[model samples]
Every structure is written in C-alpha cells, then in structure tokens.
Target: MGSGSFSISGSGSGSGSSLVLDGERGELVRAPAVRIGKKGGGKGGLLDEKAMIALRNHSEAERRRRERINSHLSVLRGMISGTDKLDKAALLAEVINHVKLLKTTATEHAKGYTIPSDTDEVTILCEPQPANTTNTSFLIRASICCDDSPELYPELKQSLQNLHARVVRAEISSLSGRVKIVFFIIPERGEGNGEMGRKILVDSVQHALRLALERVNSSMEFIPRDSLLNKRRRVSHFESSSSSS
Candidate 1:
C-alpha cells in the first residue's frame, strides 16, 4: 500500500459547492430567489380576490348609508310646506324656518289654548289723525278677546301702562267666558306717530298679551300699581246667567 499522509482538506461534492479546511464549515449559503409574476403585487397594491371582495363590501355599505340619509331628508321635506320647488338648498331652509314657527306655536299653546281657526281673536290697526283735527296724532286700535275673567281689565291696563301708552277710549264686554276689548290709544309724550312708532307700540302690546296669557294659564295673580289702584275704573262684565238675573 502507498504511504498515506495525515492532511486537512475541504471540498464540496458538486460543482456548485465550496472548498474549505477539513473540520471547518464553508461560507454561508444563500437561499434561492423566488420568482414572482408582475400581476401579483402586495396587499396595498393590485387587489387580489379577497381584497376585491372587501372593497365591494365597503362600497355597498357606503351606498346603503347614503340611501338612509336621503330617505330621512325626503320625509322631512314632505312634512314641510312650500317645498314644491326643485331646489334642495331652498327646501332645507324652509324646513328650518317652519320648524322654528312650529316650536313657537307649540310653546304659546302649551296651556290648553288652541288658536281659533275660523275667527280673528286679535287685531292691531294704526290710522293717522284726521286732517281736520289740530292735534298731530295717530290712532292705534287694538282688540283682543279671550275667555274673560274679572282680572282681564287690570291685566290689559297693566300691559298698556307698561308701554307708556295713553288709552283714549276702551270698551270691555263679555259673554260667558268670552271677553272682548277695544282700545283706542295714542303714543306717549315725545314718541313719534310714524310707522316706526306704530311698529314699536304694536310689538310691545303683543309681547305683553303673551305674558298675560302665560300668567293667566298658570293662575298667577295680577297686582296693579299704586297709581292704577287709585284710578278705579269699572269694566263691564257679562255672564251667561245674566239673561235670567
């Protein structure tokens, strides 16, 4: 046999392998490259089958939400008046104003008072002083009617007084609970008799009437001022039983 030498050598078994010293490992081997097609992008890129399904689901949900919102708006538009026009923005504005008016009406009638449908219960009229008359004054006539009570005269008088109004003449009459009053008034001293004055005076009286109604509905007492107390003016009162009395 030939003489064998004790030597250290490393070699791989194939052409692709590396050589190294015996008992020592070779260089690190890299993993093979995985080839991918152009169509197969990442999760955020080209949509796969599962991503397409998810996208369709989201789109459908958004469509349903929009449909629900439109349905509600349609119902609101139907309930409001004067919305026959095709303008959506104008219709929405009308709805807002209508809602405000409804709320005011509801609050005004909260005490079981229903506004009359066929009758005029309140009237405000302003007329210029007669040309022949020497005095420069405008006549403001206001009439209000409700279920008359013994306190109605004092309430009306107090309201007029609060506005510093001078009532030239007033007539009060009642049948059952129906009380009616006609007031002929002029503005206080130094106030104008023009459109501005009339508007202010009318608004004042209207606000006072509203407050009086609230007080009456709640059974609150009306205490006349000391000046009004001494100027005791008798108001005509009528009862249904008066016919027999």
Candidate 2:
C-alpha cells in the first residue's frame, strides 16, 4: 500500500487510548470519544522520506557546528586556565627565559659579525610609573643611543627625530655616570585609561629593552658563572679574619 491510515480511539471503561491500524491512506487519525475493540483493521501512517532526509541533514550540520565551536572553546579554556593562576614569579621566570633566548641568539649573530639592520635603528624604552602614584600607565620611551658609531648614530638620530609626532612628549636626559647618552622617555599624560592597554605598553617596552640588552650584552660578551660559591668563600675568609682580629 502507498499510504496507510490509523485511528487512535478510547478504550474500555472511559479510560486508556487505542491505536487502530489503517493500511490505505498511511495517516493516523485520533478518535478520543469512541471506544475501540481488539479488531485489527484501518491504515498505518505514511512516512515522508524527503522530510526524514532534510531533518537528518539539519541535525548533522548542527552537530558539526557545535563540534567546531567546542574545539575553539577548548583552546580558550586551556589559555584561560593557565592565565588565571599567573603570578609575579611565573611572569618573571617567563621573561627571564625569553631574555636568555634573545641573548643567546644575539650572541650567535654577533659572532658572525652581522651588522645592525634598519629595524634596530631606534631603541624603545618602557618604564613603569613611580610607586607613589595610583596610575596604571607605563612610560613608553623611544630614542637612539648610538653615539659611539657615527654611521649608526646618524641613522638612529634621524629615525627618532620625530618622536613627538609618534608618541607623547619626549625629553632628552643624560644618563648618570660613564657615557654621554641621552634617554628620551614618554610623559605620564599619554598613558591610556585601561589595564589592558597599560599591560600592552609595558610588554612592548620590555621586549624592546630585552632586544637592546641582548645587543649590548652580545657586544660586551658576558658569561654567566656560579656566584654562590664565591659568596661562601668570602664569608669563610671574613669569619677567619674576624677570629684572628
């Protein structure tokens, strides 16, 4: 049969429902008031193949979309989970590792006698605000500290000549002792209002400083050694001298 029909009727004692099977129209009709016997005639309902396929396709699409969203959410969850417990010590350690890597790479490049490129023409400095104030903005400073080499100094000077146009007001201050280098730092007024912007500024400044320090250290050729043993030896010597005195 192409289509079958069925009837749902009330059963005995004004209670219970019965479904009568009709094999002709393939439709199930409901008869709530009439009572039904155990007689086995009528039609069964038609099943629409097109509707079933469309419903299955919709459900599959929804499932795939849900899975994709869940994958992104899982990545975000992992990032936030670690960030939630981030402390000063953890941040310091991360910075130290990064600095060490930069130092190593810079030293390797210097060993090969690689000259500074256009990207290294200007130096960026990020300094935190004084402890007395309640503001959250960092002082982002940019300058050229290449007075030693005339060729490099000219390029650096030209790059940083328009510092006022790029950032907040800049001032040239002589760093105390040794060299005649001037520091061009940002003023407090240009710092933004939010913590996120402040953090970005601080991190940018730190990365720039790390790059400069790496270059300087590469030039100077600094090597790390165990200081604890020297400290212990000094303590022993001081104690022996004190005892003799």
Candidate 3:
C-alpha cells in the first residue's frame, strides 16, 4: 500500500483557516498566506515587505556595480582609440586584445640587446603635445649615460615617479661595465596649472632627473683610485738573485 502526502494548497492573504480533515476521506486543506510587502494581487492589495526590501537592496547593489564598470570603461576608452563606438561587451573584448598586443610588444622589445654610451652625459628632450593630443600632454625623452650600477634603474624610476612623471617606456643597454638608459615619459598634467606650464615643467624635471643621476653616480664606489704616480717601476733584466744595499 502507498501513503499520500499531506500537502496544503492555499490562495488569498490575511487568513489562518484550514479544511477539516477526516482520516478516511480526501479533503483539500490550505496553509496560511503571508504578506510583508504591499502590492496589488488581483482585486486584493497583497504585500511582501521582506521580499521587497531584499529585492530593492539587490537592485541597488547591481546598479552600483554597473556604474563602476561604466566609469572604468569610459577611462579605458579614452586611453585607447576606436573603443568609443563599441558596445559594452565589444569594448571589453577590445580591451583584452589591446592588453594582449601590448604584452607581445614588450616581449619583443626584451630581445633587443644594447650597450648605452659610456660618456657621463644627461640628455632630456621635452616635446610639446601634438595636434592629436590637443595640447594636453607632453612627451619627454630622457637619456642618461652612466656607469653600470645595479640600483640605477630602480632609483631613477622612483625619482621620476616622485617628480610626478610617469614613464611610458625604457630602453636599457649595458656593456663593458657601462650602462645607458633612455626613458620615454609622460608627466601628469593636473599636477601643473591645468594646461602645461612648459618652461617650468622642463626646468623642474631636468633638475630632478639630473639630481637623481648625480646621486647614483656619487654613491657608486667602483672607480679606480690610482691615477698619478711619480715614476714607472722598471722591470729588472738580471737573471741572478739581487741583494739590496
């Protein structure tokens, strides 16, 4: 013999009534209906306050998440061209492709071998923003030729970062105990007076980078100490042992 489950089916809210059960016969019983939020259900005003609040909170969180995503996407679009026309999904795909391309480029650049100039010289060129950039930024190239100190690159980069200049690319070549660094940089615009104060920026950056290079060179202890001597020591031609008087 099979036993039947005692499940109650009910409709309509604001009630706690159930059908009378006789064990031997079949009767339909209904459970009490609960409503916490206010809403129209057919002709009756039904409500589910708890569920409503939960749904509202979830919606608010989702809205905020979308806003954050859109804000980041806008920034990315500005950083890369041709992305403004894309939809959300397409924009994300383009960003992925862009990142992959940059990764491959950096890998290719690493294969190049170089030896920077041995002369202790610092050359910095600051290029004004082009027509495409709308005079909003500057492209600066700083090349420093100095003796190879292992800590030079990190210290140099940190110094520039401290000066509000963000490096875009660096070309480093070392050979024969000498090193050369060519840094392509973009200095922050807002750190200046809205538009670039060209001379002020150039002078300040030059001074800062020059100081950094000076510190690195001065701290290095690899230079030879013996330069001038009174006389050259002559090699003795005598085969036999000699006694000094």
Clashes of 2: 17
lDDT of each: 0.56, 0.41, 0.60
Task: Estimate, for each residue in 1-245, the C-alpha lDDT of model 1 and write its tens digit.
Answer: 11111123333332122221211122332222222324645543333335435544554666667678778778876887557664767777888888899899988875443222323266778777886752446777777766545566577667777885666666565443455576676666666556786788877766776666555545524443443234333445332111111
Candidate 1 segments whose C-alpha is farther than 4 A from its true place: 1-120, 220-245
Candidate 3 lowest-lDDT run of ten: 236-245
Tens-digit per-residue lDDT, 1-245, candidate 2: 11112345554663445353423334553322333233452222112334334544554666667678657555544644353355546644655676698899988876632232333344555667676643333566554332122233343344434332223343331221111222334433454447665556545554554455445435533333232113211101111101111
Regarding TM-score, does 1 or 2 come out ahead?
Answer: 1
Q: Output the worst ten-in-a-row residue range by lDDT, candidate 1.
A: 1-10
Pairing residues by index, what is the TM-score of model 1? 0.39
The true-structure Cα RMSD of candidate 2 reads: 22.5
